[model samples]
Target: MNLEELREYCLSLPHVTEDMPFGEEILVFRICNRIFVLTNLERIPVSVSLKCDPERAIELREQYPDKIVAGYHLNKKHWNTVSLEGLPPTLIKEMIQHSYDQVLAKVPKKETLKFI
Candidate 1:
């Protein structure tokens, strides 16, 4: 999906907010103030850095060598960088959803109550 489509999907999730703490070039999607998805706004083909299970992250890197790789400047074991062009839109959306769920899981129940 394109940047706009990705942005729209992320915002559709519960208690999601958009931020540019990394300046105008990088857009961040957060849950309870913790980052889960990040995209570089100026990049031609959108690239998203998403949180993922450590093992799955490694597996994906091996499977999609050219399109998916270790997260740039992120904790590699817990994240992966996904290029929109190389993967199907449905798979990308699933990855985004997984990242959102992972972050939400880490958040305290009291804080996430508002999302419900």
Candidate 2:
């Protein structure tokens, strides 16, 4: 998917909001104000960094060594930067959802109910 497609997908998630806190060129998607997705707007092919389960993150990098890697400028153990140039769109959506769920899991139960 491209940058606009990625932005649309992230905004489609409940409680997700976009911001340019790092600057206009860096786009950030947050759930409950906690970032789950981030990307550089100026970059082509749309690489996105998403929060991920540690074990799954390593497995993904291993399985798609060229298309996926440890998150750039993010905690290597808990995030991944995925290149969208040739990866399956379904997989991209799943990774985005997983990142949303990871952050949602940390929300307080009462606050989380609003998203349910």
Candidate 3:
């Protein structure tokens, strides 16, 4: 997906909000005010960082070495940076959903997730 397409997908998630806390070029998406996905707007072919299960993160990197890698400027064990240059859009969407679910599961409020 393209930048606008990805932005639309992210904002469609319940309780998600976008911010440029780092700068105008960096777009961060948060749920319950906790960041889950980060995108570099200035970069071509979009680069996004998403939280992931530690073991799953390693597996993904090993499986998609050219497209997925250790998170940029994030805890290497819990996050991943995905290059959307040629990866499947469905895979990217799943990545975003996993990140959202991982964060939502830790929020201590199941009722809040019902709205999503």
Candidate 4:
């Protein structure tokens, strides 16, 4: 998907918001005030960094060298950069959900109940 589509998908999730805390060029999506997805608007190929399971992150990196890589400027063990070009839309959606779930999982029950 393109940047607009990606942005829309991220925003569609519960309690998700977009911010440019770093700059206008980098778009960050958060759930419960914690970041889960980041995109570089100025970059070609429209890539996004997403939170991923550690072992799955490594496997994805090896399996899709051209389309997936270690997260840029993020903890390598828990994040991944996914290329938007050729990957299936369903997979992208799943990754977005995973990122959202990861962030949601960290929120305390009190804070989470506020959103729910």
Residue clash pairs of candidate 2 = none
Q: In TM-score terms, which candidate is top?
A: 4
Tell me the TM-score of each prediction against the true structure.
0.94, 0.93, 0.91, 0.95
Model 4 is weakest, by summed lDDT over 10 consecutive residues, at: 107-116
Residue-level lDDT of model 4, residues 34-99, one tens digit each, is: 899999999999999999989888988998899999999899999999999999999899988998
* lDDT, model 3, position 14: 88
In order, candidate lDDTs are 0.92, 0.93, 0.91, 0.91
Highest-lDDT candidate: 2
Off by over 4 Å in 2: 110-116
Candidate 2 lDDT by residue in tens digits, 8-116: 8999998798899999999999998789999998888779999999999999999999999999988999999999999999999999999999998988988867755
As a whole number from 0 to 100, the lDDT of residue 45 in candidate 2 is: 71
Residue-wise C-alpha lDDT for candidate 1, range 17-74, written one tens digit per residue: 9999989999999998889999998987889999999988998899999999999899
* Superposition TM-score, candidate 3 onto the true structure: 0.91
Order of models, best TM-score first:
4, 1, 2, 3
lDDT (C-alpha) at residue 109 in model 2: 89
Model 2, residue 81: C-alpha shift (Å): 0.5
Residue 79 lDDT in candidate 3: 98
Q: Model 4 reaches what TM-score against the true structure?
A: 0.95
Q: Any residue pairs clashing in model 4, and if so which? A: none
Query: What shift in Å separates residue 56 of candidate 1 from its native position after superposition?
Result: 0.8
Which residue runs does candidate 4 get wrong by more than 4 Å? none
Backbone clashes for every candidate come to: 0, 0, 0, 0
